[model samples]
Target chain A: MYENLPALKKPRVAVFELASCAGCQLQILNLEDELVDVLQLIEFAYFKEAMSNTSEDYDLALIEGAVTRASDEQKLLEIREKAAIVGTIGSCAYPVGIPGLKNSGDVEAASELVYGAKAALFPSVPVKPVDAVIDVDFHVLGCPIEKDEFLHTLTALLIGKKPPIPPYSVCVECRMKENVCAFDRGETCLGAVTRAGCGALCPTYGSRCYGCRGPADDPNEPSLEALLEKRGKTPEQIAADYALYNGYREGTAGRREAPDG
Target chain B: MFDRVIGKSDLTDSLDNLAERYRVVAPVSEGTRYRFAEIDGARDLDEGYIPTALPPTKYLRPPRENLITFAWDDEIQVEPVFDQSDFILFGVRPCDLHAIRLLDEIFDREKDDGHYQARRLGASIIGVECLEPCDEHCFCHAMGTLEAAAGFDLLLTDAGDGYYVRVGTDKGRQLLTELSGAREAVYEDRRRLRKIHARRDQAFEPRLDVEGSQIPALLADSNDSLLWDVLGEKCLSCGACTNACPTCFCFDVLDDLGLDLKSGTRYRTWDSCQLEEFAMVGTGESFRQPRDMRVKHRFNHKGRYLVERYGMPGCVGCGRCGRDCLVGIDPIGVFNQLKGQPVERR
Candidate 1:
C-alpha cells in the first residue's frame, strides 16, 4: 500500500485523547533521546500536548483513553475515517481500564456523583474500550504505555508493519528480571495472567501487580482466581482485582483457567 | 582423570588470559540471587553462588535474538544475522552444564538452528564442581548431573588452598598449556575430592521420588492420574517454571519492523508452552487449551516425550523451575506427587 507514495515522503502521525490520565501522551513527549531524530523523519501532524501545529489528514492515528460518552464514539469514528491506520495506546483504550470499570454499574448515575449538577445537560453511556465502539488496528497495552514499546510500535507502523504484541502473561518478564514473586512474600499479585510490556515494573520495585495492564491474550483467569482463593482471597475480592482494568472485556474471561499459583 | 592443580593466584591469571581472547561470562551477585552476565574481569565471578536466575543458555540463545533482517521496496532483501561473539561461559553449575547439552541436542538434532549453533560454537564452557549441594532446592545427585562427565572444556574442584582442574577437551588443554603454573595433580588432591563428595551426599535430600530411569514409564500412564487436576488448581499457569527451566526450549518467532517502512528484523524469542497460544493454530483452535492439559504436557515433555524421542530425559534437575516457582509446582515436587508423597516445601 505504501508503494504508491513517493520513496522518501514521511508518514503523517496524529496523537489523540479521550478519557485517560494523559500518561500515554506524556510517554510520547518523553522520547527525549530519539525525538529529534524521529521528528526529522516523520510529520507529527497533530499532537496538541507537545506541539501547537495541527492537521486533519494523517496516515496514522494513535488514540489514548476510553470511550465513556456518546460524543467520544462519534469523534473516534470520524478520526478513524480520516486516518489510514488507527491504534490505541494505554489500557484505557484496549480491553478496558479504570474508566471502563464504570461499565459494571450505573455509569450515568455515578457521573452525577463525580461530575455533579452538570450531568443534567450532558448525556453519557456505559464506559467501555474504544474497540467495542469502533474497529482498532492495534493495541499498545499498559497503564500509561511504556516508552520503548511506544517507539517500537511507531517504528513498525511507519514501515507499514504490524508491531509484535505479547500474548504471554507478565510472569515471563518478571522471571526474566529475576524478581522474587509477591506470592512468596505473602502478597497477592495478578501478574500470572496480566499482559507483559510494562517490564514487570511494579514487581521489580517490590509492589504486587494490580493488573494495571489488562488480561493477557488468552489469559487463564480462572486458574489465577482459584489459586488466589486457595491463598485465602474471597471470590468477591478476586472478581474486584480481575475487574480492576479489564472488567468490561469481551467474553467470559474468568471461565477459562482454574489455577494461578 | 586428566588432572592438574593451579595455585589460587594462577586461576585468576588464567581467567585474565581467557578475557584477552574471548568475552568471559559468569554468575555475578544481584542482591539476593545470581544472574549470568559478562565479566569485565575474573574478580567479578561469584565463587559461592546458587543456580542463576536464568540458565547460561541465554548466552547460547538470548531472550530476543534476531534471526534475519529484511527490507522491502521494489524488491525484497533478506540477510541472515548470526550472533558472532566468541566468548567463554565460566562457572556454570553441573545441572546447568547438563542443560547446555540438552539444548545442543535439541537445536541441532533435525533442521539445525543455525542461530543457536553459531552461539554454541562460539563459546567454550568452564565448569565448577558443586562439592556440596548449592542449597536445599538441588537434586542433581539423583539426576546423575552432580558432576559433568563431559560437555565442558575445563572442570574445577575447590581444594583448601588451590583449584583442582580436570581438562576434558582440546580447548581445556589449550588453556592449561597457556598457563605456566599448572602442575600435575598429586594423590592427595584425589583424596580431598573424595572426602568432599562423601560429606555432600549426606547434606542433599528430597531425592528424585522415582529413579530417573523410571520416569518414562511412570509418566506414560499419567494422563489418567488425578495429579494434573491437583496441579491445575495450584499451578498459576504463569509459565515461570518453563522460562527458568534449562531444558525447556520452546520458542516463538516474530517480525519487527523499523520506522523506515522498508526494513525490519525477524526475531526468535524464548516462548513457554504453558501459555495457551503455544499450540494454537490460525483457526483459533488450540490443542492444549485447558490448564490441566498444559500442566500435564510440560511434565510429560521433560520426563517422557524428550526421553522417547531422544533416549534421554529432558530435565537436568537444575531446580530453577522449583526455586523460582511462586507456587512450588517444581518438577521434583510434582514427581513426588506422582510417588504418592504430595509434599510441598522448599
Candidate 2:
C-alpha cells in the first residue's frame, strides 16, 4: 500500500483548532523523531502553531477541537469545502470532550461564570464535535491524541488507505497487560465501554479509564451499568464518569453501523 | 551411573547450571498472579504456581513477532527473521503442556509456520504434574489433561522429600546427568511415587457434567441456543478470555514502515476473534456483527472445529480464561448449561 507514496505528489495539509486546550495540537510536535521525515512526505499549507506560512491550498485539514461557536462552524465548513479529507484529531474534535460537560447544564450560565462581562463579546454556543458541524473522513481519538495513532492516521492518509481503528474496548489491552482489573481494585472504571488503541493507558498505571477516546464499537451501556452497580457504583456515579469526556455523545454516537466503512 | 530422581535442592542446582548456557524460562510470581519469565535460577521459579495468565505458548509464539524486514534503494531487499535462540520452558503444568502439543499440531499443519517451527525446535519443555486441581475454575480432569503422557522432555512428580524425574527423551536423560544428586529410583521411591499418583487421581475430581468427548456434538447442535445471547450480554468483547486462553493461536499481520519510508518490517501480532473487526472484510461487511455470534464462534472453535480438524481437544482446561475473565465466563459452566446439567461447585 505504501509503494505508491513516492509516485504521488506531496499532499498539502493544514491544522486548525477551536474551543480546546491546544494540548491536542501539541501532540503533533510530540512526533519529534518523525517530524523531519514527515515533512518530506507532506507540505504544511496552514499550521499556525508550527509554521508562520499560511495557504488556502491543502489536500487535508486536520481539525483539533470542538466547535463551540457559530464562527467555528463557518470555519469548519470552509475547511470542508477546500480539503479533500477532513479529519478530527482528539476527543475535543471528535466527541466534544471535557468541554461537553456543560452540555448537561446551562451553557450560557457556565460561559458567563467563566468569562464574566467579556462573555457577551465572545459568545459561546453549545459544544458540538467536528462531525456535528462538517463531514469528517476520520477521527484520531483520545483526550490529547495518542502520538502513535496520529502518525498512523497521517501515514494512512498519505498512502491513500483507510486508517485502521481497533473496534474493541480498553479492557482487552488492560487484561493483555496482565494488570488487575481496575474494578477489581475497587475503583470504578469505564474501560469496558471505552474505545481501545491507547493501550489501556490509565488502568496500566493504576488509574481508572475516563473514556477520553469515546465509546467502543458496540458498547453495551446496560452491561456497563450493571457491572458498575455490582461494584457498588450508583447511577449518578456512572453518569458522572460518562459526563467527564463523553457527555456530548448520544446513547449510540460512537457505535458503528454496517455501512460506516 | 545417572539417577532418575532429582531432589528439591538438586533441581535448583540443575536449573542454576543450565542458566549458564541457555535461557531458562519459568513461572514466577508477579504481584498476585504468576507469569512465565526468564529466570537466572530455580530460586525465581514458583514451584507450586497455578496456571499463568498466559500459557507457555507465549515463548514459542510470542504476542508480537517479526516475520520479515525489507529495505529499498535501487531495488527492494527483503529478509526473513527467525528466532532460533535455544531456551528451556520449565515448570509447565499438564494442561499447558497439552496446550503446547495442540499448538504444535496447529502451527505444523498446512505449510508449516516457519516462525513457530523455528522457536519450537529451539525450545525444550519440562512438565510438572499437578497433584490437586489448581482452582474452582479448573476442569482439567474432565478435559483429560490432568496428566500428560508425552510432549515433554522430563516429567517431575512431587515425591515428598524428592522429585521422581521420568525422562521422556535423550535430552531429558542428558539434563539429568548434569544434576549431582540425581540417582536411579529405588524400590521405596517407586512405591512412594505410585502412592502419590493414586492420591493425585482422587484429588482431581471432574468438574464438568459431561465427558470431554461429548462436548463437540453438544456445541455443534447448539447453533441456535439462547445461552449464547446470555453469554454475549455478559461478555464485554474485551478479548481477555481469548488472550488468556492457552490454545488460541490467531494473529493479524501488518507492515510497519521506518522513518525513512524506504525500510519496513512485516510483523504479526496476536489477534482475537472476539474483537468486532476480526470478522470484518475489505468491503465493510462484518460476518459476525452481533456479539452473540462471536461468542458462539469461540466455543465452537474450541469444542467442535479443532476436534474435527486435528482430532484433539483445543481447550486444555487450564482455566486461565475463566480466572482472568472480568465477567466470570467459564467454559465448564457454559458446557454444563448446554448439557442440561446444573452448575457444579466444589
Candidate 3:
C-alpha cells in the first residue's frame, strides 16, 4: 500500500450574507444528496447558519444577499479581503435582485408598512447588488439560486477553471423545454430579455418569466419594451416588471447609493 | 405500390395487425397540446389529429441517445451502441412524413449515421393525408409538402365509410395480408379521394408571397431583407423553434460517467442553432454572434442552403416552430416579408 501522504487539503469555502433573504444560501443546502459529496471535497470555514466552527482563512467566499445597508457593505469588504476567491451567489449578489426592486419610488411608505415609526431606526437607501459595492470574481445567478450551478462554481474554482456561463436569454430555454408561448396566450413575458440558467422554470409551468435571474449576456430592452407596448403594456408597467429583479440593468433603479445603517 | 379499399372495421384490423408486429405510435392529446406516443390499440389513436409538438423523428434520433460505452478498470475499452426498435409510425401527417424524407437526406449523406439509419430502416411509416388545412397557421400547401408521394410505406386517405389505402412499399404490401376485409379500391373510391384533395387545395390559399419554387431565388436576393432584423429583435434565441422543428437534427455530444467511475457512456443530446453558443468554438469565437444573424441563418438554411445542397426543400411546413416561437416570428409571415410582400395589416 502507498504511504498516506498528509491528506490533500480540501478547499476551504465560506457562505456569507448581506441585506436580503438567505434564499441563495438555502440552495446549497437544497442539494440534499449532492451536498454530502460536496462537503467531502471542501472544508466549511464561515457558514454561521450551518456551522459554529468558523474561520476567516478560506479558499473561496460564496457571498449571498444584496448590499443595501452601510453596515452590510463594511462586512462584505472584510469577507472579500479574507477570502482567496470572492464569488457571488444569486442575483442578490450579482448585479440586481428582488431586493433591488425597492429602488423605486415611495420608500418611506414601503418602509413604514414593515417598520412602522421604527423605520427611522433603520435609515436605508436604494438596494444595490454586491458587485456594485465590491468586485466579484465569479457569479452564480438566479433569485433563489440553482443548486447544480453552485456546485459547478465550486468545482471550477477547485480546478482553477471558469464555470460555463449561460449565454442566451430564457426565451431559448423556454423553446428547449418546448412550452407553449406565453405571448400567444396574450401574456407579456420578459423571457426574451432575461438570462437563462433557471431553465425557463416559470414558463415551464405556463407562467411568464419575471426576470428573476437578471439581464442576459445581451439584452435588447428597447425591442422588448416595444413588444410589451404592442401588447398593450404601459412604459411604467414594463419598467416595474423589470425592476422586480433587473432594476439596475433595466435602468429603473435611479441614482441612489447604498442604505445608511 | 398497390391500392386497397379498407373499410372502417378492416382499417382497424389492419392497424391492429401492424401493431402486433411493430410498436405503433400515434398522436394523443396532452392537455391543450398533442404528442406522438405509444399506442396499444386503435382506441388510443387520435383520429384527424393535428401535427404533434414532437415529431416521429424522435424515434429515429432521440433527444438523448448513448453513442458509445467505455469501461476502464484493468484496461480501457470502448464499444459503439446502435439502439433501434421496429416501430410503425401511424397517422403521420404529410408535413411530418416529408420531414422524415428530409432527414433521410441529411443522415444518408457522405457520413452515414449508423444510429439514425438503424432506426430509419427498422421503422415503417404510415402517412395520413390532410383533407383540410389544420388551422389558419399552417402553410404546408404553400410549402408544397401537403401531400407526399413517397417516404411512407402506406398512405391513408379518409373517405367517410372507409379509407382508401395506397401501399408505397413492400412492407406495406406484406401487412395487407393481415387485414381481414380489405378489397380492391374501385373507381368510385379513388374518385372521392381526388375530390377531397381538390377541395383541400382550394382551402390552402398561399400565405407566403413567393411560390415554393421561387423560395431559393427569393432568399438569395433577400439577404438584405429588413425582416431578419425585425425577427431577430423579437427572437428569444431559446431554441424552441428549432427543437420543435421537424427538420432540425443538430445535436451535441458529451461524456457521462457512472457513479462507480469504472464504466461511462458517450451520449448525443439535441442541440439548437438558435442558442448563442451553438457555433461557439473552444477558442471563444462565435460565428453566429448576434440574434439577428442567427435568425437570418435559420431562414436562409431553410429557404436556400438545404435546397441548394440536397436539391430539396429545407422546411416541411409543419408549423410547430411558429406555433411555439411565442413572438410570432413564424416562417409564413417571415417568408412573405422576405419577398417584400406586405402582410395583411391587422
Candidate 4:
C-alpha cells in the first residue's frame, strides 16, 4: 500500500555510524522478509558500517550513534545537508544511548576509565544524541529496533504516510499475554512505566523489562514508584533502574535530595 | 400516583423478577473488596458496600481486545473485530458513570473507535448513588463526579424501604416497567429522593483544595518547575497509577502467533506510559528519556494536555492511584505541590 515514497525519486539512502556498535544497522539488515524490498526502494549511497560505498548526496539518511568526536560533528552536519528526511535509528542516535552514562562523570575520569594510558588519545567531550547537532525528522527507538517496526516505518515513509506511534505502556502487553506479573514473580520491571513497543519481550521471556524502547506519551510515575517500593525495592534501586537508559534526561533519576542526618 | 413502598426483605425478589428477562450485573464481595460480576440471583448484589476493586469499565472495554487479524504470504488479508455483545452494567457508581462519559467523548470523537462505540451502544448503565462515602481514598466530590447525572440510563437512590428510580432514557423507563414492584412516584417519594441527594451532597466533603478548572493552567505554567525533578527522583517508573486509573486508556497492539506463525490474532491491550519504552521508536530513539520527563508528561496529559485537546480532564478522582501508590504520590498532592500549597492528604 505504501508505494509513492519520496525515496523512490532519488533512491539514494545513506546509513552512517559514529560511536555506536552498529547493532541498529544490523537490525535494519535483519528485516529479512522486507530487506530486499527496502534495498530496491533506496540506493545505498553511504553506509560505512554495512557496505563499502561513500557517496555525497542522499535522499534518505539513517544515522546511528552519538556525536563523540570533532570529526563526527562535521560528518553528521554533512549528512544532514544532503538528505531530505533524516531518521535517527537507535538510542545512541536519539538520546546518547548507554554511552551517555558518562555524562554525569567528568571527561577526565571517563577518558581515564576508557583509554587508561592512552587517555589523551580518546575524545575528551561527552557524547550527545544526533538531534543535538542537526534536525532529525523521525526516530526508531529500542537498543536494537524491532524488525517488523523497522520495515513498517520504512514502508510508511516510502509511501509518504506518517508511521503510527504506539501510545501504551509495556504492562498492557504483558497482561495481554496473560503472563504472571513481574512484581508478583519477585522481579522489578520497568514495563508499567516504560513505553509499549517491544511487545513486552523481556517480561514474556521471564526477565524484567529494561526499558529498551523509551517513554510513553503519558506516564504515571508516582503509582509505579509506590508499587515498586511495596514490592521491597529501595529508593536507590528504583532510581538506578530508570537511570540505566534515561540517565541524561534529568528526571530519569527522580527527585534528588540533600542527605539528612 | 402511589408511593413505591416494597419491604427491604423483598429487594432480592424485586431484582430477581427483573433478572428473569434482562441480564443483571451487581456488586459482589470478592476477597477484601467488592467487584461487579454477573448475577444469576439477587443474593449476588451487595447493597451497602465499598467501591469495587476494579471499575465496571472492564465490562465495556476489556483489558485485551482483538483489533484486526491479518494473513499474509499470498495476498494480504485483514479482518477488523468489532464489539458485538449486548449487556447491562448494573450498580455502577456515579464516578464510574462519569468515567464512561469521559470515555464516550474520547471514543466517539472524529474517527470514532468502533470497538468502544459498539460495546457502549449495546450496553445499558444502571447507576446506584452512594449512601455513604466509599472510603477515605475516594475524592469524587473534588472532581464533581459524586452524583449521577446524564451518562447513565437509570439512577437508583435508596429510600428507607425501596429504591426511588430515576429513569434517564427510554431504555431505563422500559427496564423499570419490567419490574412489577416499581410504581409511579408520589409526593413523598419525590421528597425522599431530594433528601437522599441532599444528604449525599453534604456527606461527600471536598477532599482536595485546588480548583478543577485551574489545573490545566497550573500544569501548563509548571512545565519546567523543579517539582518534576523532585518527583522524578522518588519515582520508580513502575506504572501502578496508570494501571489503576479508570480513565487511563492508552493501549498497544501486537500480533501473536499460535504454534503456526502464519495464523495469529492482532490484539490490543492496555499499556501504561510510565515505563521507559512507551515513546521509543523502532530506531531506538526515546522521545522522553528521563523519568522526570516521562512522569511530567503523564500528569500534563491527564491534567492539562488532554483537557486542552479534548476539553476534559483525564482524571476522575477515583483515588485508586493514591490507594495503590506505594510512596504516597497522590495526584492531588502533586497538583497542590505545583501550586505551592500545603497538600491535604487522606
Q: Please, what are the lDDT tens digits per residue for candidate 3 over residues B1-346? A: 2688778987887677767766899887766677788888787787857777777788888878899999888899999988666788888888888888889888966459998888888888888889888876788887889988788898888888888889988998876676679898878888888898898788787787789889889888878766777677777676778878888889989665543435768899888788777888986688998888999898889878988988877888888888776568888878777777633332
Give the worst 10-residue stretch by lDDT in candidate 4 chain A: A252-261
Best by lDDT: 2
lDDT tens digits, residue span B270-320, model 2 = 899988889989877899988889999999999889989988878888888
DockQ of every model listed? 0.45, 0.55, 0.32, 0.09
Cα lDDT tens digits for candidate 4, B1-346: 3234444556567678757766777888744556678888788887776666567887667778898877776877788888867777788888888888888888876549998888888888888788777777877777777866777888877887777777777777666655565667888879878888888788887666678788888888888788887777666555667766677788878665422224557888766677666777886688997877988998888788777877655777777667655456788788778888533332
lDDT of 4 by residue, A1-261 (tens): 122335445368888887778899899777676656566666788887677768887788888887777788898888878777888888777656676666655767888988999998876666667777787777777787777677656655754665544555676666544355666566778776666667788888889887766665545666677777888899978876776665555332233221110
Residue B41 C-alpha lDDT in model 3: 72
lDDT of 2 at B306: 91
Instruction: Please list the residue runs of candidate 1 whose C-alpha ends up more than 4 Å from where it truly belongs after superposition.
Output: A1-14, A29-46, A50-61, A77-85, A100-126, A151-163, A185-187, A204-208, A226-244, A247-261, B7-22, B41-43, B72-77, B108-111, B177-181, B341-346
Model 1: DockQ against the native?
Answer: 0.45
TM-score of each: 0.85, 0.93, 0.87, 0.59
Off by over 4 Å in 2: A1-8, A250-259, B1-3, B341-346
- How much of the true contact map at the interface does candidate 2 reproduce, as a fraction? 0.45
lDDT of 3 at B300: 85
Model 1 over residues A131-239: C-alpha lDDT tens digits? 7777677778788888878878767655545465667778888887777778877789989888787889989999989787777765666667767988999977887
The CAPRI quality class of candidate 3 comes to acceptable
